[model samples]
Target chain A: MKYIIIASLSSLILQSYLTTILKIDTIFYPLFLIVNLIVLYKYFNKDNLKFIIYALTMGFISETISSNTIFLQPILFLLISFIVIYISNRIEVGNINLFLIVPFIITIYRILSYFILNNIVHISITNQLLYQSIYSSIVINILYAYTLNYIFKFISNKYKFSMYD
Target chain B: MKKIKVNPRYLILSILIIIVVILSFISYAIKSGRQLSPVESLIKDTVLTTQKILMAPVNFVSNSFKEYQEKQDVYKKYKELQKKESLFDLQEAKLKEQQTQIEKLNELLTLEKTLSDYTYQHAQTLNRNLNYWNNEISIDKGTSNGIEVDMAVITNQGLIGKVVSVSTFTSRVRLLTSSDIHNKVSVKIKTDKEDIYGILSSYDKENNVLIIEGISSNKIIEKDSVVVTTGMGSIFPSGVLVGKVESYELDNFGLAYIVKVTPTVDYDDITHVTVLKRLK
Candidate 1:
């Protein structure tokens, strides 16, 4: 519960900073997803499917708050969340590797989704705007995700967890 | 008589799956134009309110810092003026001459009288991101106020940028000097006879210069000419100051002059700006 609060607060701060300071139009889903994933990983049993659902929910909430896209973002997040959790479970590596992999996958997913929506559906994100957005997500999302991971770890250690279990 | 066993874990998992599916269906239904549950609207409103509250302190601190810096600069300039007071008479005459020249330039361009119909709401700059691709800043105003996307934003000196996105109480603006490839601006050069058309291209930060293309070769292009918006599109008015030409060179094919410009607005010191509401 404490980690969730911290993660949400940090997400708000980063969101404001990105919009106000960077002046770039961007979404902070990767940061939100990574934080929630860390919380689920530490508290819930690795084998439980609840972890997957929670990650998906976090992704959905994050993207919805950031932009105008409605149902598409949540559905896309569910699929990506499942893939990230599955891969992380299969690998016995340290937490850092999982952190790195999640954002990279999310970034790729966002770009591919953008292409499908704008090109196939004829939604029309100009080539220049699309490239700028992808570049921002790649650079900014990685740093924000890592920071959130560490902050979540700190919060988890400070408070006992019942929500995850 | 075979013994049958049921796994408790399997039962719990099945129930969880059912709940998730039901929730998903409800979410989809709401997204597809079904009326939002009262609870959903409440949640959305709460989140937006919290975001606005969170931004307030950040805006306060940033604005204070800017004020402090401005005060320091004024103090420094004051001290320098005191030291140079012995030559004040001579400097005053030169300053008056420069002021006259500025007035003459304004007259030559037939600059409109400053509009007084709109009252400005001051906003504090929360951040400045000046990377090669994304040049932008965020301010502490949004749709809840009178700010709308695509509104022209400018400082006292010249054009700053245009509003891009508006949250409930915060907005994002894309700066004119952003190096992002998408930042194309249509501009016009004020010549002795008539205004000439051009497009703003590359931005050189090191030298604080902007490159403009599309000027015709036959036009009598000269260094130090003023460039302003042509009002070709609905984006800006016809004569908002853009920059002055710093230098020009003939292109390789001699089709157009490669004109460099120095923007009139001091982007770094901008703290407050006005958003021009289009005349109805």
Candidate 2:
């Protein structure tokens, strides 16, 4: 529950500030995807179907409000979420390795979707946009993931909210 | 008898994947080259209203800081204008005579006072987002506020974009900077001799320039000439300033001119805008 709140709030703040205040071109790299992916990986369970749904809903709404394609982002987010959980379960990897791998996965998924689904041609897959996305997702979102993870871990330890159950 | 055991996690994941696929199909059906249905309108309105309420404080803080910085510059400009005020007063009568003569000529040409006389509604931007192909910015005014599709969106600087979709409380505008191939506008170039006409087509996003095509190479289009809407289509009124020509060159076949334009409106500073509701 605490993780869900933190994830959603961070998504909102990033949406509000990144494009308008920071003035960074986020057309290629969606920062919220990384946030949602981290949440799913941290708290994937049989009992947490509600969390999955909530995260997916937030991701959809953010993309709809921010981008042209309403349906595409949510579907991609869910697919990525499923893949991440499956991969992490199959292989025991450390947090740092997972963090490093997330950006490459996202960039490749975006490039494939841009070509196959969106039918956009004549655009290079490995352009500056790919580099920017890799930089943003790894450098910026890794810090975000750690900060939120630390805060949640602290709260769960102190409050005894029975949040996991 | 033996019972097969299954993990609930896999079951839930499969269900979620199915749901995502179903929702995507429905969304694609709803958006299949038609106007938004009532359900889509309701959803968009709710989201936009929530976003507007949430962004109020942020916008206030940002605008306050910007206004403070602009205050000093405003004062300096005011002092400078005051110095020139007396000299400009002498030219006012002569300018008025010239204006009346121009209006008379415009009346004869059936091109009634261009963009200056349109009824407009002021609206604040809610948010802006971009995708791989296009950029969309939402505004507070909507159908309830008399905003309709295809209305020209402009700021004090110049043309910003046109409203593409409208709900009850908010409207989504497609920015002129969008790189969509179909996002073209008929424009006229204001040269010293005569106005040359062309189509303002695709945007060069990397260089922040607009490409104006279909111009005949024989036409003497001067560099730095102002470009404005031709009002060929009822979507936008005539003479609304768009941009200035930066450079011009011949096409591959050397038959027509491809001119580059520097748009007047700064996309980064778009906060408040007005929707032009044509009088006619």
Best by lDDT: 2
TM-score of each: 0.60, 0.81
Q: Could you report the DockQ of all the candidates, in the order they appear? A: 0.15, 0.28
Candidate 2 chain B: minimum summed lDDT over ten consecutive residues — where?
A: B26-35
DockQ, candidate no. 1: 0.15
Best by TM-score: 2
Model 1 alpha-carbon drift over 4 Å, by segment = A22-66, A69-80, A92-160, B1-49, B58-72, B79-119, B124-139, B142-144, B155-157, B164-186, B191-194, B199-213, B223-225, B244-273
Tens-digit lDDT track of model 2 for B258-277: 99999997775677899998
In candidate 1 chain B, what residue range of length 10 has the lowest lDDT sum? B29-38
Give the lDDT of residue B191 in candidate 1.
Answer: 76
